[model samples]
Target: MTNAPLILVVEDDVQISRVLQTSLEGAGYRVAWAATLGAAIGEARSRQPDLVLLDLGLPDGDGLSLIPQLREFSVAPIVVLSARGREEDKIRALDLGADDFVAKPFSIGEVQARIRAGLRRQRQATYAEPIFRFGNLRVDLEGRSLRRNDEEIHLTPTEFKLLLTLIEHRGKAMTQRFLLNAVWGPQSLDQAQYLRVYMAQLRRKIEADPARPRYLKTETGVGYRFVPED
Candidate 1:
């Protein structure tokens, strides 16, 4: 039998974590729990979970700080589970690479839906077209290599995924929410800042002039589009 998808639940609150574990397992996911940022990071590295449910207010430190470390080794989608409901808090988490954000008092059904959406996006990206090219920029999706002007351009996994998502929908204006959901997962749909930050980074690497980008065009208030040629 295939092993159920593994979900790491990182929350310091015992009751909340327990409830999450029960709910996730009931939905056919295998669950792992961590009560602190340190344990969450360590377990995430060791266990290599398929998804992470992270709580920002950990006992040891802020969970937002763990995102870069987690990104380094795993492309697993991270869904933030926090009591902090401010828009700024949500933006911060998504910008740092959290796939989705679930505030306190969330319904188990909503969380489950997010999890399913995240997993589906991950699977699609993983099995997407293996190669894409525009001008001198060449992307070998299966090989995970990118080159511009025949010179190698190294990209973080997150950046690479963003680029690929844009390429997949070339010539179409992808809204901020659609791009965020496609690349960072559904929980990040509202985090336009994340898209801005990464798009700038991508432009710097691929465009001859970052300020006057030819391929990556901004739709202003909508989102972005990728043009194969000028």
Candidate 2:
């Protein structure tokens, strides 16, 4: 069996599907594509891809319909790639079971990064012990504790949740909307300022110097990324 992670790209547009396949393969990931929803379901079952990049607009039916069905059989992470940009649409997809969402006309670099993050999170979830260590920072998943050099680091409930979300998907650029939805809730998706405020608090508590953050790096117009130490 091939060791490279397999990604199923469910897109109807031929050219777009080609681009996605080429890009993913170029990044050393094995890819399978299906233009229709039925084909996608079949491919997914047979191949058991490591991740799925789904497009909401499918010729046979709504791609959203496949999310729950896919979930019935596989625990692989699903990242929606579609033209549906409205907040409700995104929330609906997330609620349905998608791990992440990227609207159409997205940067290839960003999508690739998100895919890597999703795969990493999926693997970590299956681990017997999901303890993460980065430099002086350590996160204990089962105990829900944070420590710096063996000393417990105090984090407010909100701050702790935000930090956990980032660390769980470390190495991926999480959009502001995604972060808000995950940390706050669907109603708080519009509250960008809340994220900024909490992120500042997190940085102050965790960083050696908040001015020069090492782990919680911002993605400028996008969102934030948790860069774990090598």
Candidate 3:
């Protein structure tokens, strides 16, 4: 149906692609498949999928390279399914604008959940409501203020800007360099320590338990992700 979300599966393995297509279609998503990087790009351009499931290993070229190119034309959420589980590879993919990453030998249920979450986050970004809510926390974009259970919590201008940047890309793994450049400008791209300092400051104010944050989560070596809870 035209109303169903279109999912592009860019995978070279025939069996894997078939499994994904069947599973996704059963989950109410319309599926499109591409076995190579070139065909992937062509299908993406023609179909303009609502989301993409990319495999880093492709016959023609590395699928990681397709991320930036896809970003050029579409804001559709990209969930990378790859066997390369190295920390650096994940960091590179996220830095290149991937929405999420799942390793090979992945669960069908997990992949479906990731797709649902990615699609939900994409819709949120598209609509971009001025007010964001998760549990007791609230962020008012237009008002530029944060509140917890209706109690106004003050944040410094810089801290607010940092938080705002994270909120804008909710559910995505944002690299430190990306956050730094966005908030502090390109000149401060190397100042990752600033994020550490300010993030602590933010947690102190917003988090019920600063030691274990519910919203602003660290992605180990990657960066930060703003997780929204219903």
Strongest candidate by lDDT: 3
Evaluation by TM-score, superior candidate among 2 and 3: 3
Query: After superposing candidate 3, which stretches have Cα over 4 Å from the reference?
Result: none
lDDT of 1: 0.82
Flag regions of model 2 displaced more than 4 Å: 128-130, 142-144, 155-204, 207-230
Q: What TM-score does candidate 2 reach? A: 0.72
Q: How much lDDT does each candidate structure score?
A: 0.82, 0.86, 0.90
lDDT of each residue in 1-230, candidate 2, tens digit only: 27999999999999999999898889999999999989999999999999999999999999999999999999898999999888777767766778778999999998997898788777766773668888888888778889998699988888889988887776655778889999999999888999999999999988898988998898666677788842
- Say which prediction, candidate 1 or candidate 3, comes out ahead on TM-score: 3
| RMSD of candidate 1 to true structure, Å | 10.7
Model 3 residue 40 CA deviation (Å) reads 0.5
Clash count, one per candidate: 1, 0, 0
Better of 2 and 3 by lDDT: 3
User: Highest TM-score among the candidates is held by which one?
Assistant: 3
Off-target runs (Cα >4 Å) in candidate 1 are: 130-230
Q: Estimate the TM-score for candidate 3.
A: 0.96
lDDT by residue (83-103, candidate 3, tens digit) is 998988988898898989898
lDDT of 1 by residue, 21-82 (tens): 98888888999999987898889988999999988888889989988889989998888888
> In angstroms, what RMSD does candidate 2 have relative to the true structure?
4.3
